[model samples]
Target chain A: MRQDRSSVRTERDEQFHDFVAGRRAALVRTARLLTAGDTHLAEDLVQAALTKLYVSWPAFRRADNPDGYVRRVLVNVLTDERRRVWRRRERPMAQLPEQPGPARDPATGPADDALRQALRDLPPRMRAAVVFRYFHELGVEETADALGCSVGTVKSQTARALDKLRTALRPPGGAAPHGAASHSVVLRQGVSS
Target chain B: MMDLHDRLDQFAGSPAHPDSTQIDADVARGRAALHRRRVTGAVAASATGVAALVAAVAIAAGGIGTGGVGADAGTGTGDRTTANGSVGASADGAGDGRVRLVAYTGAQPKGFTIDTVPDGWFIQTDDNYSLLLAPDRAKNPGPNADPSRDPVYDPQSFVGKIGIMLQSKDAHGVPEGTTVTVGGKDGVLVKSRPAMTPDGSQPPADGDTGWELYVRQPTGIQLIVQFWEGLGLTQDQMIDIGAGVHVHKDAAQGVG
Candidate 1:
């Protein structure tokens, strides 16, 4: 019996190590977006989620869609952290700044910093919706499932989030001419994915 | 113009130096957490077994003595209402709503000092944030349980325990109940649903009711002494317990 327990522990640890090696980067990236570029907080969230995952590894191994389970834990940890007064501090810049690319018209959207700031402005769950839908390219239903919310809630939150992002990204001159069209296009892109 | 996806991608730029050591750290932390859970569970189980054994021994020796308990120790479904209309009842045939608050002869925990504890109860878990007074039969989670994560943290372990802690930082609005006094300071004796039931996150299942005594300290921090219905303590006893609770400087201030 003791030998069996030891073998199970070894198998669990080995699998967890492999899971971490294989998926830690993607998880960190998703968490980065969820925390609005706060790389430190993103890392903390991933670490916490990984720890919880490890604790429940026996059950986790038997479960299907392990990635979904991990993502759900990650999002839950972020939201719970958001509720804590001690962790309610401001988010710092993402560790990796945006790379310089072809310049876009300033009137069309906000700069990278502006975009990060806008994402940070959103409520935690709303920010998670935006990240899952846009950044991770998850379908609305998948995002809803990850968020443990209804699909309609995901749609409304994503739409509202996009609206806020669009508003925040809008240039000093006026609303962008294609704002409405862009909104519809974004929703369609999120849904059809 | 770049779409939302494109912009998000650009914003979530690749990490400059993704530390390979993080995986090791994650594993270590995970292992430590797993160990803590196992240790806590084992300790709680051992305590439960010992308590059952002691109870059986006491029953064999005739009966359990309530040395410091109140005089109205009738073994019945003692359900009564306070004059102020707060729900009062008892469970486990302990007593009616009324219970004698005897001097808590146990070791005083940090953050808060209690002059009185309910009969057959002691400070099971204590921290600078809160103090948990648990009955002798409770499966004590030892002193390591975090009160900040109460109700959700080992739900069954905390059931029927009296919790004393400061009001959360974001706690506002006067709780509706009868006004009372504790240690010469104004307090509120409010009846609330048990934050956690044995089943799960559900509150006060099977008509279970709890009590909360919100006593205002001189420093304006309201101390809350919550009584689980299983204790069957009356509001007056709750206030008596609240009166004995003295907050110390070491007590950590609550956050939302």
Candidate 2:
């Protein structure tokens, strides 16, 4: 019995290690967008999600979709973290000048900073839906499963999120004569893809 | 016109990957956490087995129903109501009759008691905060509630919650409000916009208002009772809740 338990533990650890090694970068990228480019918070979210994944390794391995399970856990962790009052108290203001200033990598250009700020301004769930649907390129059904919501909710949230992003990123002067038509085409391509 | 879709694609493409060393550290941390959880589970199982064995032996010895210890002892019970109808019944019977203040000896925090809470309100405490009194009508999505749909951090969901936080000294930096006496202790009552969102974003204009009473004990401990105005609780009622607080003089600081 002891030997069996030891072998099982070793196998589980090996599988979890491999999963982490292969997917850590992608998970971190998703976490960054979810946390609005707060690198420290994104790392914490990834660590928490991975730790939870390790705890449930046996069941997760038995499941048909391990990536989906991990995605669900990641979203849940981010949600729970946001609900904590102490964490809320410690969070920096949304419109703080220092945030956009320091996050601007000279190499990445100004557009990246503006996009990050726009994403940051979104409500947590709206932002999560946008990230999972657009950034991760998950189907609406898949995003719904990961978010533990119905497909209808995913569609609605994604639409609203897109609306907000469009309003935030709209050109200062106004939409060009052909901008709306081109934007629609781009949005359709994104949704279809 | 910049396409939002392209912007999001570019945003997602940004590589913020942790270094290999950090990954290794995270793996080690995860392993340690798993080990700790397993040990805790094993310990809990062993304890349960021993307790069952002891109970069996005691029963065989004809010690079945002799009240070894009263689990509810020192836990406050329903009693008389004050003139203001603040607290009257046991916490278990919140809706039985007039509100009854009970001594809260919960694991998270001590030395404070809630006098009056809306019917169907439940209390949860996991930290130094005195208690989180959530409305009964709120759907408890349990631990597995989906972030995308339920959005646990939505401020509207917590519109009626009353949170009591205990701080050792006046470090909260709460802007001073009108001075009021609560439970024979002088306290400052301050009103502010509801708490910011988890990401430090301002709540919508229509969000609930926040009322806080910071009462300083003679022992230098500060007891803060906070509630959202969306619950429609009156100032007198809020004050009465603060006034009904019974702080145990012998309670140690940060015991929670």
Candidate 2: stretches off by over 4 Å = A1-9, A86-97, A100-111, A175-185, A188-193, B16-19, B53-256
CAPRI rating of model 2:
incorrect
Clashes of each: 0, 6
Identify the leading candidate in terms of lDDT.
1
Q: Write the per-residue lDDT of candidate 2 for residues A1-193, one digit (tens) a residue.
A: 3464423446767777778778887887788778887766676788888887777788898878878898898888887666433312211121234543223643222346767878887877789988887766789999999999999998899887777777676656666475453252145364652
In candidate 1 chain B, where is summed lDDT lowest over 10 consecutive residues?
A: B196-205
Collision pairs in model 1: none
Tell me the alpha-carbon RMSD of every candidate.
12.9, 15.6
lDDT of 2 by residue, B123-189 (tens): 5432333445665444466776663564333322334467665652213344568788777788887
Location of the lowest summed lDDT over 10 successive residues in candidate 2 chain B:
B196-205
- DockQ for all models, in order? 0.18, 0.21
- Expressed as tens digits, the lDDT of each residue in A56-84 for candidate 1 is 89878877977678778888778656643
- For model 1, the superposed segments whose C-alpha errors exceed 4 Å read A1-9, A86-111, A176-193, B16-20, B62-256
Give the alpha carbon lDDT tens digit for every residue of B1-256 in model 1.
Answer: 5477777776665543335576666677777778767876797799899979866765666455643233343322345544234445432224443555678887887789999887777777777767777766445545876645554244224455787777765445446888998989999887663332111123332344566788888888878777666565656667778888999998865543
